[model samples]
Target: MRADRLVSLVLLLRQRGRLSAATLARELEVSTRTVLRDIEALSAAGVPVYAERGRHGGFALLPGFQTELTGLNHDEALALLVAGSRRGAQVFGLGSALASAMLKVVDALPESYRNTAAGAAQRLLIDPETDLLARRSVAEEVPDTIVAEVRRAVFAGHKLRIRYAAADQAPKWRTVDPIGLVTARDQGYLLATRSGADRTYRLSRISAAQELAEPAQRPERVDLDRAWQERSARFRTGGDQVTVSVRVDPARRAHLVDTALTIGAEEPEVDGWLRLEAVFQDPRHAEWAVWQLATHAEVLAPQWLRASLRERATTLATRYDVPPGESRPSRASAAATSAATRTPDSTAPSK
Candidate 1:
């Protein structure tokens, strides 16, 4: 660990040019004293590390000093630097380690490629916290300690005990043989087996975790990617799914397709509108997807969904409708209208 820290210390100075002991301590998650010691160790090992004394001073490597670890060409190094900028490392509780490793990658690059690659990486952006629509992407929050415990068990091939909170149910403790951890779109899940049955638990829902000392009961080796794919296929197909036929405007077809799980039997109408049968998770899901497109899309079949949408549209129309040159009712007036609509028995105490 100290050797790794010592290498990280050198890489930090090499990448950032100059960094104060305090800054290094914070980055390394150690005390300033430890940073100072690491600096001494690096210098004693023939690294040309020097410190400046004034208030605006920090440790820096001599100019043109870099590690001889370069093998990647310019494009390969750029690809790595760009991938490193992504938020995947944070999903697995290795954000700081990723930073350190990225620093090493930069510091180890050939001087001819380093500056250009690093600058090019800065030009590209990946998965910003918010998108063009100004909608923020919310990542599931998993406690560091809990994730650490779960991660250890997965890698060490040990049974893991977790206080898991499944949807709409109280948290329950269960022991499972670990398979692997998978991250998709910033959400983390543990693929494991409980009592020889396949189980996948969201890392965020793990309120507590403990790695058992006993070895896991499972195959000696497995293909995690294939396993995850199989599980995903089952999940997508096994739900209470509903299929709906719909006609959508050409401009809004993509919008409709995005929310539906599958599309079948598509044909263009004479009026230039497109008709298609789409499958969604359920009726509610279908309603929501079609509703978002408003008049641009219309549900053709599933009479109940059409009625539900009609009722919702009617309610919205009633709420927004007003006579010409007349303003809509205020909150107080609306409240009075609601009160007036109630029968005497409506508010009467229950028997």
Candidate 2:
């Protein structure tokens, strides 16, 4: 560990030119005392490291010094930076560790690759704030303490005693062997088991957690991707899922499947519009999804959903409809009407 730390210290100084002892301590995840000792060790080993004594002083490597670790090509450096920009590593409380590792990676890149790799990464965006419209990716906030505990239990092969709140149920304590942690839609889920029964607890719903000293009770090795898929399939099929028959415009058929819980079947119609049999969580959920493709999608079965959607459409239309004997107001006419309706004393500055 010390060897690696010293090597990192050398590489950091080589790339950064100079960094304070506290800064090095933070980057290395060690105390300032440890940093000083490592500095001494590097200097003793003829690493050409030195510290200036002034107020603006810190550790530095001699000019012209370069680490042998500069081996990553430009493409490799760019790839790593792009992956880092996704912020996936931050989900499990690895934000600092990822940052430290990325610093080392940048330092290890060849000089010719450094600026170009950084520039290329800057030009590329991963999960930008506003994407293809005003839609944004929202990062879920899980308590740092909870995330740290869950991460430790998962990676250390320890059982976790968790107080979890399942849907519509009171919070209860359970001991589960953590299989892995998963992140979706910026939220974290812990996939675990209790007495061979599959259980998943959202990180946001964990009120309390304890990492057990005893080892986990699950299998020796886990294929997390396979486990997640299996759990997802069970959850989807366990409930009273609704099925709907719908006619979708040929151009918008893909959108139907994309928004539904799952596509149960698909058949082409002679009129060119495709008829899709889809499963949704429930009638209400089906209504909500189908409403998005108004005019482009027609729900054929589940009369209750059709009625509900019809009621909503009727209500919306009535709200904006013009009264009898009144001409439809154009934009300019609406603005003039609004101004005329204002209070006579409203010449004061607008609120």
Candidate 3:
């Protein structure tokens, strides 16, 4: 811990120039006497650190001594410097500081190296396609100020009063003890609880949130990342998992084996196609997933999924009203019908 403190003290001095001994001691959780000893050790090692004795007394490095920049080779230096010019640099206020540091490095370079480094810098470019602000907008619907307040509540274990909006539901006011903020696609989600029930609310949908003066009692520690992963796994499992057999087109079958979803044994099918056996969690996820290889896959098992897909296909077919005489169904064939509404001429059997 003392070594850690010493390293921190040196880095702080390098970055901030000076700091009061009392302040350093408080920061390192050590006594002023130890801080003085640490300063002495730094000075003894040719660190050029010194202490002033009176009203403005603090530890500082002797004027004009900067760390030599010889540690980094040309490519490494170029990468580090170019990273600061990337699109998100403004988010951390690093552009100007990086430029200044790069200049110092250039000034310290031998004349021979100076030209080469400049040419390498010109060849390298860091262009950020997405600005930090735009990327941040995808994570949460709310502004930075609101996220700040929510973070404070989460970290402090405080109960918050929030006005929330849900999809197609009337806005409701509620009190919840915030557990943590979840980030998805650059938006912030508040995962919290009210009366022992957990809920998720988009930060964008929150309005007029305020933290209470008194903090609520909570577990000493909560692992938010673990909770998110477990919940995602469970949600995937929520849908029925059915054993299925499908015939896939030759062109689309390879993509099947390459995907993350389970694919069972394959067997020869008609017209040189292949039949695949698999189990999928949700029909909804399956539908979307298979759509990616639309012409390539044909569902063959459990009957219900095939029926569902057929119904969905019928609906889509009716939308375009395929002409009756053509290879497709008549345009009106897409019209939705069921046992309750089917005419006698309709081939759809009555229940």
Candidate 4:
């Protein structure tokens, strides 16, 4: 830890030129005494660190002294900086570590590339709270201790015991052998197995976690990417997957697949519409996705899904009190019906 702090301190000096002892202490979250000792240690090790007297002065690397972190070109340094700017690392409790690492990378770059890399990275934006369309993609928060425990079990090939608050279920204790950890957006997941059954636990939902003493019952060598893909495929195809064959208008055909759990085979009909075999999360999911598209999308099969949609539509139709046998009107139909229902006298001034 001291070595990490010392490296971070050097990077700060390399990036900002000279910095005061108090500044170093504040940046490193250490004391001025520690900073002084590190400076002395650097000098003893022939690192060319020197102190300057007077209020405007502090510790600095001698002119032209730069750490040799080579084989990295300008683009690589910029990429590293931009990546460091993201909060994905923060979700796993690596925010401070990422910052320190980024500092070392920038400091190690060749002098000619360092400033350009820094400036170029500052121009790119990622994962802003509100995106370009002003829509907030809210982030999930996980406790530091929970993620640290989960990460430890994953990387160290150990089992983990967790108190998890599963969605729609009461909090319960579970012991699992962690396979890997995955982060998407700002949320993290623990991909693990219990009794050889694959399970995924959202890291944020873990109220408490502890690394188990027993070694994990897992393969010695794992291809995490392959394991994740296999788990995902199983999850998508095995869960309460509902298949809904649908006839969707051309305009809504693309939209249908956008919201589906899986898009199966599709065929274009002679009527200019496409009949698609769409897989949805469940009946409720099928109903919700189709209903949003209204008459533009029609559920054609898997009687249960069709029935569910019809039930909701019938209820919706009743809510509006349209005469029985009068079909629900879409936007265009409603406009035409509105015109047909009115008389010329209705628009004329009364005598």
Candidate 5:
């Protein structure tokens, strides 16, 4: 670990030219004393590292000194820099390692490609946590310790025990043969097996985890993608799935399709709308998804869903309805009322 840190320290100096001990410590997540010690170690190893004096002083490497680690070309280096900017590392508790690796990648690039690649990567954004509608995407929070243990078990091919709280159920401890971890749409899942039966657990639902001493009872090699797909197929076909017929505005048809588990048949309506049969996880899921489209979507069949939506809409409308003389005040009227109610002292600036 110290060797990695020492190499990182040297790479930092090589990339950034001059950096104060405090800055190095902050970047490397260590003490200023550790940074100083690293500097001494680098100097003793015959690397031409020296310090500048005064308030604007720091450590720097000799001019023209570079490491022979340039194995990536221009596009390759840029791709890596951009990928390192993603949030997957944080999901797997590898954020620190990723940061260190990114530093090394940048430092290892040829001098001509380094700055441009880094700058270009900064210009691109990936998987932002919010959309243009200002709706924030909430990522499930998994405790770092829990994720670390789970990750260890998966990589080391050991059994894992977890106290998991499934939806609408009490937390229960279960032991599973760890298969692998997967992250999709900012959510983490552990694909494992219990009693030789495939099981998937959401990492956020895991309150606690322990890596067992026993090796996992699983195959030597696994195709995780195929496993997940098989499980998903079974889940979709086995659940209390509800099929609904709906007519959606042409513009919102894509939105409706995106939320459904599957679409059976789609045809254009006479009024330029689209009529389609969509399947959802359940009736409640069907109702909620159709409700999101507001007036742009209408439930055709599944009379119960239509009734439920009507009841909900009526309730909401009644809640916001006003009587004959109790209309909401306009903004201008409210502003005037506020001015009229204010006293001279209330409006005056404080001394």
Candidate 6:
């Protein structure tokens, strides 16, 4: 514990350049008396530690103090370099600064390890062979500055004031005690607590964020990742569960149940008869599922769903300027329609 404290204290001094005795004591989990004693030990050893009092307060070290680092193997050095590179310029806030710090670390390393790391960095190529990466399709981009602020508050166990936009209302400012930030497949989510309820806000919907001066203690019992995972799973599977029955062409039904094909619900029914059933959370989401089965599958149950499907069909016809009694688009035409509804990649946030 003494060694750990000493290491942390030295690193903290390096990071802050100066710190008050009270601040150092609190950060190092030691008494102010112990911090003063440690400072004495460092100074007695010619470590260049200095102290100042009164209005201009705290302790500082003279510039150009160099600490020695030793005893790391080639593999360990390579791993450290790789980790440093990934964390350096790859993320927001402290990333670029951290990366610059890593260059100093590499420069300080022994020649053998430095050459090994530099060689690895040069030999390794991370570029993609094909341009298969589709552009990001997030609804709105979350700004890096807001993300940095949220991260700071979350890590510091502080509350944050955020301007958040909800689906049914204008953007409103709220104070949230941030627990963590999460990035899902196509979105970023912030898990926080407000008014005694755990909530998740889409990062893109957060127009602005600022740290609150009030520091609220976080609950030690809360596991943010576990809580968010459970919440997200429920959202995916907990919608109104329904089983819809449909009859369609057996050939088309096989394809619907197997390959991906988009055809009219009636077309498959007209071609070859096939019967099927599936579950859904919402009637609309389920209807869309059945609509995908179109030409191959027909809605057999819950007359309301059947009626709703007809209304949807009518609406589609109107939108496309198709006359009544005219057949809807084929699978190829529908593919283009689906593509049109997709959000553009340009809307996503930058790396």
- For each candidate, the alpha-carbon lDDT, in order, equals 0.83, 0.79, 0.66, 0.80, 0.84, 0.67
Of the two candidates 1 and 6, the one with more favorable TM-score, higher being better, is: 1
Residue pairs with colliding backbones in model 5 are: none
Q: Rank the candidates by lDDT, best first.
A: 5, 1, 4, 2, 6, 3
Whichever of 3 and 5 has more TM-score, that candidate is 5
Q: Give candidate 4's whole-model lDDT.
A: 0.80
lDDT of 6 by residue, 1-351 (tens): 354455456656754678999998987657999998888877887778888878758888787666663233332343354353342223223333343344446656665786688778778855322336865333345566887788778867889999999866899999998877665544567888788777889877888999987885568567767888887766656756666667766656564554222223332334457555655656666777778765456677889889988877867765678776788777678779979998879979988
lDDT of 2 by residue, 244-318 (tens): 999999888778778777887788999898998989876667888899999998999989888988989976775
**Could you give the C-alpha RMSD of every candidate to the true structure, in order shown?**
6.9, 10.8, 15.0, 9.7, 11.4, 16.9
What TM-score does candidate 3 reach?
Answer: 0.46
- Reference-based TM-score, model 4: 0.67
Over 1-351, each residue of candidate 3 has an lDDT whose tens digit, in order, gives: 354456556655654567999888876557999999998887887788887778877998766676653343332343354454332222222333343344455656776886788789789755434566664332223554565577678868899888888866878888888887665544457778778777777877887688887776566688988877876676545656655677888887777666425776877876899888765666665666566676678877768777888777877766567566556534455344444486676776778
Top candidate (TM-score): 5
Candidate 1 lDDT over 1-351, as tens digits, reads 687678778778777888999999998989999999888988888999999989989999999786864344432343354355356556666665666667767776777998999899899887799998999877887877898898789878999999999977999999999998887888988999999999999999999999999999988889989999999888767778888989999999998888888898999999999999999987778889999999998888989999999989977886768766777787678779989997778768988
The pairs that clash in candidate 4 are none
Better of 3 and 4 by lDDT: 4
Better candidate number, 2 or 3, judged by lDDT? 2
Give the poorly placed runs of model 3, Cα more than 4 Å off: 1-140, 165-171, 194-199, 205-208, 239-245, 249-283, 302-304, 315-351
Please write out the lDDT profile of model 4 over residues 225-330, one tens digit for every residue. Answer: 7877887787777767788888999988788888897888989999999999899877677888999999898877888778887878876765588876777767
Which is the leading candidate under lDDT? Answer: 5
Between prediction 1 and prediction 3, the one with superior lDDT is 1
